[model samples]
Every structure is written in C-alpha cells, then in structure tokens.
Target: MMSDCGLDYIELLQQEVDRTSAKLLYLRNEEEPEEAPPPRHTPHTCSAPRRLAISPGLGGKPLTPPFTENLRRLLFGRTVRVFNFDWRKSFFHFREPNSELSYALQVDQGGARAVQMVIQARIIKHLLFSQQGGSEGRSLLSLTELGPPEQQGALAAALSDSLWLAGQEESATVTMVTEDDSPKPPSEYRLDLLTEKMHTFVFNRKEELSSFLLDHIHCFQEEGGHGVVLFLYSLVCSRTIDRIREDLDSSTAHLLQRRLGNFVCSQALLNLLLTGRATPHVCNGTQAPGGGAAPLDPPLQGVLSRGDIGYLHWSREQMDRDRLLQVGSMLKTPRFPVWLCCINSTYSVLFSLTRSLLSDWRTEHQFQLFYYNGQNSQNSTARLTIDTHSHHWEAPSVDPGVDLEKRFPSLEMTIRTKWEGASINWGGIPPFY
Candidate 1:
C-alpha cells in the first residue's frame, strides 16, 4: 500500500509540472506570431482574436484610450463575485454589485477560452449599459443618439457582436467556409444596419415590420443571426415595437420563436440580470447524423413554474390570436407572479418573479395594457395577476420593498404612467371589487 501511494504521488507531481510548463509555454507563445492561421472549423479560437480587433466606438472608430479605461473602472469599480449554479457543469458568473447586473458565461471545456468569453461579455455589458448612466437611464436610444452618427453605428455593432458572444454560438466575426458553402464576408451581416432597419420597421410602420419580419424569419434561424434575433426579441419585450395587432399573421413569428427557444436558453442571461445569478441552460452538443448541426439542450425543459424576465413585447392582438406567445396563458403558472414590463424597444430591463405584487381578484384573472407616444418613445409594464386594485398608475411611485425606481428612475416612470386608470378585471366584477 505504501509503495502504491508513493507511485500515485509521483504521478500527481509530474502532472503538475506538465501543467505549469504548458502555461509558461503558452505565455511565451503569445509574444510570437503563428506561422499559419488555424484551419477552418476551429470553434472558440477564431472569435476571440477577431473580436479584439473590433473598435470600441461607432462606425468602426476606436474610442479614446481613456474611454475603455473609464468603462473598466465603472464596471469593476465595486464588489464583484462569481459562483457556480450547477455543480456538474462549467458555467461561471461575472457580477458587479455597483452595476446590479450578472452575466452567464458557459464553458463546456476546461481552458482559458471560457475565461476569455466571460471577459468579453463583461466588456460588452459595460459598453451597453454602463455607458448610458447605468441601468436606470439605460436606453438604446441613448446609445444610438448620444454620439455622432458614425459612433451610433459602431455602438450598435458592438451590441450585436456582444449578444452573439454571450449566446456562445459560433463566431460570426470569424468566417470559415467549407466546400459545401461559399464564404459570407462578415460585412454582409452588419448589425448596425440591421439594428437601424429594425428600428425603422418596428417603430415607423408596425404592419410592414411584421410582414418584413415574417419574410426574413428564416435568416434568424441561421447560426450567425441567432444572436441578432435574440437581441431583437429582447428589444421587442422592451415594448419598443408599437401597435402590435392581432389581425397580423404571425405563424412565421411563432415558428421562429419556437426554433429560437429550442435552439438557445436565454433564461440564464435573464436570471443573471434579475437575480444576479450566472446560471444559463446548457447541454452537451450532439452532432446530428450526416454531419448536420448539433442542438443545445433546452435549458427550460425540466424546470417548472414558467417565467421569462427580460424585455417582452406582449401585444394584445398577437396574444389573442396565439396563446403560445402569451405569458399568462402558459400551461403551468410559475410559483411566483410573473413581473413583465416593456421598456421600449431600444433597450431591455431585467425582472424577477415576485408574488408580493399580486393582489386577490378571482381564481384566474389576467389582463394586459399598451402605451406608445405615437412613436417609439415610451415604456410600459405588463402586470400578470388578476388584482382589481383601483390604484391609479403614476410616475415616481416606487415598487413597495424594492428600489427599482431608484435604480432606473426614467424606466419606472415610463412603465408606471402607461397603466394609469386602465385597470381591467376578468371576474366580471366592477373596478371596486
């Protein structure tokens, strides 16, 4: 037994030496250029170096050196923590209390790549949220309008790229073509242009946007655009898309959503923002037969009590036609009342499941409301309970026991005023019930 133990200890020591040697060699390698680029189909390696090449300003202009330094200082200035949600997996949490935001970065393999992805995500969040007076006054409108037109485009592109990174999908920035397909230059899918079009479509002509979305829904399912689609979904939830009507045909919309829901689990991201947990749904990728694409394990499949806590655009007409898109009509009611609100289409806000907001009305009661300033300049909240409280909606009202108003004053007012005096109860009772 002693001899066996001795042999095991020696083996362990040798392994440690090997690990240290490999790390030192890696550090040395960074100083040298590779003689040849990696072959196509190499996954995480391609995006990292390419993404670093991105300019921090709009329209490919690099920000001043101090700009990034300021962002880093703002993002990581206060306390930060990281923890594992699931023991068996390699997901990590990147959080800062000062920002009140958490990000989920998934790692399927043990290496430096996972850490790189997390750091990438951190920079993206800083660029998106912290740049615009933190989460309270956070607005894509600000991102778009705060700087020069050129800078706006750059900022939008950064957001698009950041969302792609967080999704952990293949790198769109680094293109590698196989014989089966032709190369798609990264310029083809300019997120800044796409974002501009989305804004024009959703905010200008609502009907045209829906039709346009239906026609182009297939693009979202493709690997590279999935992140963009997710970004749009969150944008819509922000209530940026106005005049969502039921007469509009959304079969294509439903199909696209189903595919996206199955393809990626966004709850991990939603949770990180709402509750500061970095737990996202992940599954081992299993390549399909005949070398087809592999699918991500549906993260929300096993969990009960359904709630989505991101920006949601709950169109009454759309929901009336198709209940599948409706949160309240889901087959299973979450243990806590769902807190959903639209924060305009320009940005997204995080929500948590809380029952304290629910009030007694009937066994089952639900209603929704919408608000827009005839343009895209409005935010609204969707209460998912049957409470018939005759409370008038007003701005500057704080959520009881919550400092949401303080965190995001502009957002609170935007949502609060939209629901003013428009209470609807389903119990056939009067407003005074």
Candidate 2:
C-alpha cells in the first residue's frame, strides 16, 4: 500500500536532517565558542549587513544566521518553510534597545511556539530596555561564565525581575520538560518531544529562583535544550498556572495545538504574548458571543491591557466570508508604534522609529514604515511610505455594487486599523501582501 514517492520523500527528508545534524555537530566541536561578545554593542549601522536576530546559544555567543538556519533546517527540514523572522533565526541580547538585529528576533510563524517566542521577545525587551539600570549585555554575553556563582546569581535575579513584569503584576508559571543527559535535543530533532518528563516550577520569591535557573541554564541554552521553549515556560510560571488557565476559555484548553505534524499558537496564546492576559479575541475587552443568547461560561477574553508591542490581524479567508473580527482600539492603538501584523495568518512586523507615530496625528500625513516578511530572500529592510489624506480611499474606481472589503489589499486594511480612513501608497514598491 505504501507508495514509492512517499517513501522517497521521507528518506530524502531524513537524509537532510542527518546531514545537517552532522554538520552542526562538527561545527560545535571544532569551533571554539566565539570570544565572549563585546559587553556593549553599537546599534546596527546601515553600513554592515545585519544578521538575523537570534538568541545566544549554550556557548553564550549570539547565534549567527548560518547556525540558526542550520537549526531550522535540521529541526523542521523541508517540512516547514524557514523564515528569517522565525525564532530559530534570531538571537537574544541581555540589553540592547538600539540594536537593529534585535528587530528580527520576534516570531512571525503560526504555532504556539511562535506565540511563546513573541512573548519571550517582549519579556527580554522589557528586561533589557524597560529597566534603566538592569543587567547589561555583558552579563548575558558569555553564558559560559554562568558557572561562576556570582554570575549565576546575577543572571537569575535579572530573569526573575523580567518574568515578574511579564506576568503583568500577577504571578507567573514556568513549565518545562526535564532531560536527564546528552546535549542533543530529543527524538525527531526536538520536534517530537511529546514523551519528555514535564515539570512546573514556582519561585516563592524572585530571588529564590536565581540558583535553579543559573545552574541549569545549559538545559535551557544548550544545542538541544529547547532553550526558547524553556524560556517561555519560565515566563509562564512567573505568571502562574492558574492565570494561564483563566486566560483560556472553554474552547482553547492549551497554548499550542498540533497540526500537520507541527504546532501552532492559538489566539489566546498570542493575546498573552501581546498583553499578558491571554485573552483569546482581538477586541478591546471581554465580550459575550453574538446572538445575545445567554453568555457562555468563562466569557471570551480580549486584550485587557496593552503590551509593549501591538498586534494587527487581517484574514482574507475571514473577510471574504464577512467573518472578520473588528480588532478593538486597544490593540489598534498600542502604547508603542510597533505592530506585529498577522496578514492572512502569516506574521510580519511593521514599525516606525517615531514614538509619536500613534499618538500624534500631525505626523501621519506622510511617513515611512518599515516591513520585514522574515523570508530568506529579503536582504535589506523593506521601507514603505504611508500617505494619509492623499488619495481618496473613500471613493473606489471599481463598481459601487462590488464588495469593497474584498477589493483592497489586506495591508491597507491593517494599516487603516490605526489611521481609520487613510490611503496607502506603496511608493513604487509593489505591495506583496
């Protein structure tokens, strides 16, 4: 009953995994972890090519693109298309707000892991930039030094504080799988970690958590440690399990749902990543389902508080059927100008350097907004000009009888979330979305 083509595909995929894995193993052994990175890094200058933003590895070196590319190629192989914006391609710095490489570190993919990675990026940003005199990049630059008791304590305290804030004032919960030995990740190259022993941890106080994490930092950062996932678990723990449960409604029982042999994030998980409340919907606040029937148990949760970054969602599938959820103002109007946009279920980031881009209406007439699709093809940042009050978006050239919502490019609709009735001029750069 088995077809030869299917068998060939499996065999080829397995060979790729093995080849990539071997290549990485060789690199890890032969290559001494790069010198402890400079404690302080200058902001990405337009002069140098910006590497994909990936977190440091077990070796304490900021992961480079080739290495992360190999990671995704090894783990997902050809099964899933790899993107530069995927968590695997980025690195984490202890504190570097003025860094360009940091921009690509967020997850632009579809799974629960993607959501957690996004939340993890926010947590790291809060730790590094939010606090004025917190741990410097030097503190995290060389994880090899975590063995030292002093450094271990310092790292722990810093992580604890960040996670505390990540909880949004509520306690957090950290859930992780326990591994006994070996540096390599589990079967299926860390993709099939279903049977690993899982553990949930709570630190009575933030300081008390310093030792365990410092001692086991390798378990989180090592080549096979599932470092990102471990980091997410720690953040969740700081928020506590109870809150995570409350963040979900009857429909979504967990943060991730498996599909097509891979895992993807739920809206609740994404809301948690954005606002920390894990509200499932995109609306401003909790709302009962339509039809005015008796409200369902555990009323639908929307974003309660705005997070550091905002989210914009536009689904053509949902819009075509007139099922688009009107994302509320709270999400549309965030505390910051950066937004993680979900266009047709794929994630992309749109941001402006001007902090007042959202609050100040005067600056909206003509401005530059940068976009990154996370695809490997992109070598430089794509810049787009948004011209509001320029063209008459109100009057379309198309027949009045046609459905307008389905006519416009999805990106225009997403941007309109903030500008209301602005026209988008691609500035001669063909709009991809």
Best by lDDT: 2
Q: Write the per-residue lDDT of candidate 2 for residues 287-382, one digit (tens) a residue.
A: 776665465555667777666677888888898777776888788777756677888877766766555777778888887776666554454456
Q: Which segments of model 2 are wrong by more than 4 Å?
A: 1-102, 106-113, 116-162, 169-223, 292-298, 398-407
Per-residue lDDT of 240 in model 2: 51
Q: Estimate each model's TM-score.
A: 0.24, 0.60
Which segments of model 1 are wrong by more than 4 Å?
1-128, 132-145, 149-154, 157-162, 166-309, 313-433
lDDT of 1 by residue, 246-267 (tens): 1112111111111211122233
Error of 1 at 28 (Å): 57
lDDT for 108 in candidate 2 is 30
